[model samples]
Target: MNTYSDLRLNLFCQSLLQSVGMNKENSLVVADSLIKANLEGVDSHGISRLPIYAKRFGDNRINIKPNIQMTKKSSSVLMVDGDNGLGHVVSYQAILNGIEMAKQNGVTAIAVKNSNHFGTASYFCQLACEQNLACIVLTNSPPGIAPWGGKDAFFGTNPIAFGFPTGNDQPVIIDLSTSVVARGKIILAAKQGNHIPDGWALDRDGHPTNDAEEALKGSLLPLGGAKGSALALAVEILTGLLTGAAFGPNVKNIYDNEESGKANVGHFFILMDIEKFMNLNTFFESIINLLNEMKEVPKIPGIDEIRYPGERRKRDKERRLQEGIQLPPSVEEELIKLAGQYNVEFPIPIPPLKANSIVSN
Candidate 1:
């Protein structure tokens, strides 16, 4: 395991990305998104993905310099073409436009196409939250989950996220995948030579398996059986069909070297200005009252406290910032190789603490 401060890690990532033909501004945005995911304990979407991204860039699967364009469909609707750019760069630009339109027209809907994988959806939501706006984010990915009662993979492990500003500095953010677990978790396990728990996925022959590699060749189970499959369908339509991007199994998988083409991932974002409906303070007070009531009523055995959505993430970010972000040996080794390949300086790891040095006084 290796630990690193966020600033040093960000610089290392930026250097590596720039070496791969990405511009400085876009590299900074991508690195910030990856590091923030690690800080919030979502390691699946963190810097562990750098190797795959670099490979795609080298293969010409993702454009190094994309021409992102936006069109105004109406007073509250906008369309974006990423021109095969990184999802982080495309989505960040789209959300900024959406927020501005919402401030003028109460709400805005933005559809993005021809993009690659974006990090966690909550990151974009946090941007809207900073402006006291409510937002819903949806995105389609490469196929990983299967439809209800099906043996083959069909729908992507599409995710949906919602964000709302509150009286406190922390906003209410809910982000989740329609699958029983995120497919990235299985990919990370496979990379680390670890076994996954049962019920997360099935083998290629439709049998349950704990092996991460086999699970990758198979289909992931839905979050709640048929219900989750249904939600995934809705996201597929909104992000893929409605946005004119690839749908269902047609979305190209980023990890498959044999699949030669763009990912064509799609995203949908809706931003709503709170002041349009009512006073922002009144809405904050109502949300606070509701949260307090819920906390006052919750206590099960072995439970310490009741935390609202995004609260634990906020706490994790705080602790990680104070200490440091730890990376697994597998991820660190891959990063080191990339550093050498790109002729970039790698960040020095924080030394592990010695047990004998601890003195309890």
Candidate 2:
């Protein structure tokens, strides 16, 4: 296993992005987002996705110097054109605009189009939580899941995320994909030559399979059968259809090397100023009380603690900050190869592995 401090990882990622012609500011934002995902223990959205991003940038599928623009449709409604930029850069700009608009108008809705894979929705939602605001974020991805009872793929994993100020430093965050699991997890499993759990995905013929590689060649199962499909449909409507971006089968998978044209991904965000609804201090105090009450509830059998959504993530982040982020050897090797190809120096020092932990390719 390879371990890295957050600062070194961020700098390495930024250097790679810069070497590929991304502006300093955009590179910094994207790198920070990726590192944050790693810190939070969301490996699927972390540095594992870096090689694909680099390939896209080299292939001209993602624009390095994008002219991202915002259009104000109303006092509280806005639209952003990403100009084929990396989704991290584009979505970050949109969220910033949404936060400002919400502060001025008490609420705001911002939609983005022509983007390419943003790391994760929770990253932006947490940004709003930091400002003492409530946020909901939805994004449409490449079609990788089928609708209810359908064999062929027609919907993206389509994640939804929400964040609320918890009256404390750590906000309540809920982030989930409508699919049974995030597609990136399957991608990681494939990279590691591991098998997925049963019922997570289907083979190309629509039969469930535990093989990650087969799942990749097929479609992912929805979270709750028909219900998850419905939620994914709603996200598609808001993110892709409403935003005039590609939806359903029209969206291009990020890993498709032979696919031509831009990704044209879409994202939708809703932000609310908590202070506008009631006194901020009072609201926070009430939340804290409710959280305490929930904690007092009896635990189920064999359960040690009742954690709220995002608690585990917060804990993981704290531990990783004090310790270091761990990377699979394959991921580290890919990063090293990417650095060499781009003429960027690998910033993190790799430690010699002990016996029995070496991963075979």
Candidate 3:
């Protein structure tokens, strides 16, 4: 394992992306999104993804220079065509547009099509929250989970996220995948030759498996069995079918090298300007009061504290900023290889600290 400061990782990622023909601005946007995930302790969606993304860029699967187009459909609705661009670039532009539209109107709904896999959904939600806008984000990926009572994979993990601004406090952000676990975590496990816990997925033969590789070749279980499947179906409809992007098994797998086509992933965002509905201060007070009351409720034995959704993530980011992000050895090796291939310099690993260095101090 190796640790690296966020700044070094950011520079390394930006250089690699630029080598693959991405613009400087777009590279920074993508790198920032990935690093933010790491800072928030979501390592599965962090720079571990860059190697695959760079491979896709080299294969011409992702468009580095995309002709993104936005169409205003109604007073509070819009559509975006990503032109097969990187998902981070596409979604960043979409959220910015949505935030502006929500400011003008009370709310805005933006649907994006022809984008590749975006990193974490929370990244975009944070962007909206920074602008003092509440937002709901949804995106569909290649098939990973099966429909209820089905053996074949038919739905993506299909994450959904919501963010609410709290004036002086950190915005309340909630993000979750419909699957029992994010497919990326399984992929990371496979890469590191680790076993997953049971009940997370089934083998290709429809039997439960702890092997990450088998799980990848099979189907992921839904978050809450049938109910999670139903929610995933709804996300597929909004992000895939409604957006005119590929859906179900038709969405191409990001890791499949044999199938050479764009991913055509879709994302949907709803942003609301807090002031439009109620006084911002009043809304903040109400939300804080509700959170405080919830926290004051009785707790089970051995429980320390009850925290709101985004509180832990905020703390994780602060800690990681001081300690640096750690990368698994396998992921580090792959990143080093990518750096060599791209003719860019990989960031030096942070030196490990020596114990008892302050003896007799």
Best prediction by lDDT: 1
Where does model 3 exceed 4 Å of error?
354-361
Candidate lDDT scores, in order, read 0.92, 0.90, 0.91
lDDT of 2 by residue, 246-280 (tens): 89988888787778998899999999999999999
Please identify model 1 stretches exceeding 4 Å from their true place.
354-361
Task: State the lDDT of candidate 1 residue by residue for 1-361, as single tens digits.
Answer: 7678877888889999999999999999999999999989999999999999998999899887999999999999999999999899999999989999999999999999999999899999999999999999999999988899998899999999999999677899999999999999999999999999989998888889999999999999999999999999999999999999999999999899799889999999999999999999999999999888988886999998888999999998877776678899999999999899889999986556721232211
What CA root-mean-square deviation does each model show from the true structure? 2.9, 3.4, 2.9
Comparing 1 and 2 by lDDT, which wins? 1
Q: Model 3 scores what on Cα lDDT? A: 0.91
**Which residue pairs show collisions in model 1?**
none
264 Cα displacement, candidate 2 (Å):
0.9
Give the least accurate 10-residue stretch of model 1, judged by summed lDDT: 352-361
Query: Model 2 segments beyond 4 Å from truth?
Result: 350-361
Which pairs of residues have clashing backbones in candidate 3? Answer: none
Each candidate's TM vs. the true structure?
0.97, 0.96, 0.97
Model 2 misses residue 295 by how many Å?
Answer: 1.9
Q: How close is candidate 3 to the true structure, as a TM-score?
A: 0.97
Q: Arrange candidates by TM-score, highest first: which order? A: 3, 1, 2
Counting clashing residue pairs in each candidate, in order, gives 0, 0, 0
